[model samples]
Target: MTNHPHASSDAANALAALAAAPAAELEHILSEVCSSPAWAAAVAAARPWSDRQALLAANRAAMAGLTVADLNDAMAGHARIGKPKAGDATSEREQAGIQGVDTALLDELHEANAAYEAKFGHVFLICATGRTAATMLAALRERFPHDAATEAEIVRGELRKINDIRLGRLLGDTA
Candidate 1:
């Protein structure tokens, strides 16, 4: 994975700092990227990453190592898909494509989110960046019939995609 050509100098510096930060601070930073204490602690403990790719690979491995409870904890940090909260810049930006949608579409998304949560006991997680409201809603509908085990696996995959995107963003990748 190549770094974004327009990555800011500050992001590069932040990456370097992250590689050397103390365990507590490192975990704190990693938590901001994905909100699982276990994931944060594991990734942080494996630090002094040689580069962004190495860091990302370790993140993927750490995520894969999590138990169902840990995945649930990570999912708790995300807002419902298509319903970005005020002042949450990360969610707001990630769900930007769904902004300004009509009330009908938003209502459908709301119902779908509730149904998904009722079935899975967690928020519907997706990598919403660059996807339209309709697309997200369609994906939710498509996944509604998945068995519990299947849905759990799907959630894990989505979380991985989200973590990758967030890591890239943390490194100032504008793309």
Candidate 2:
């Protein structure tokens, strides 16, 4: 029962104990473990997990299963401020590699981001891993030109990516 352990011999036991938990308990455990609805819903559906890989596989499968409503619910927990918060815990954890920008730059990005959201009727969505702030800004600018249908699909994809990150974090839970 340490705070950190990776793929330990007891991992299967821990996972089974979680997977066997009742739905309310599952939701509660997973809620503490991960806050995203898409991730939580996916974990909840991953009952009877065979092992860590099975749990991860279920998490991925769940992302693929997300409905538009589910994606929006997942997105609800993230920052959609007129400006992005540099290193916002939720976004940083979910999109650490993908969404970080220099704190100094968020102020400048705010107006353009707001204008883009205003035109699109939804917040800009990016997978936010392995990219720079400037890169993300460029993506936002480019995506702004996309029509609603295209943007909707892109948002859905972004939500799925977030779900994946949350699931990995939760599945990497304490021993």
Stretches off by above 4 angstroms in model 1 are 1-12
Give all candidates' CA lDDT scores.
0.85, 0.64
lDDT of 2: 0.64
- Candidate 2: worst-modelled 10 consecutive residues by lDDT: 166-175
What is candidate 1's lDDT per residue for 1-175, written digit by digit as tens? 2455545566667688878777777777788888889888878877777777788888889888888999988998899887897899998998997899999999999999999999888899888989999999999999999998898888888888888888887777765
Per-residue alpha-carbon lDDT of candidate 2 for residues 1-175, written as tens digits (9 for 90 to 100)? 3445555645566676777788888887666534556667776876787776777677667656767666666555556533345756655544443345566666656766798868976567776655566766778888888887777778767655655555455555421
How far in Å is the alpha carbon of 169 misplaced in model 1?
A: 1.6
Clash numbers, per candidate? 0, 5
Which run of 10 residues does model 1 get worst, by summed lDDT?
A: 1-10
All models, RMSD in angstroms: 2.3, 4.6
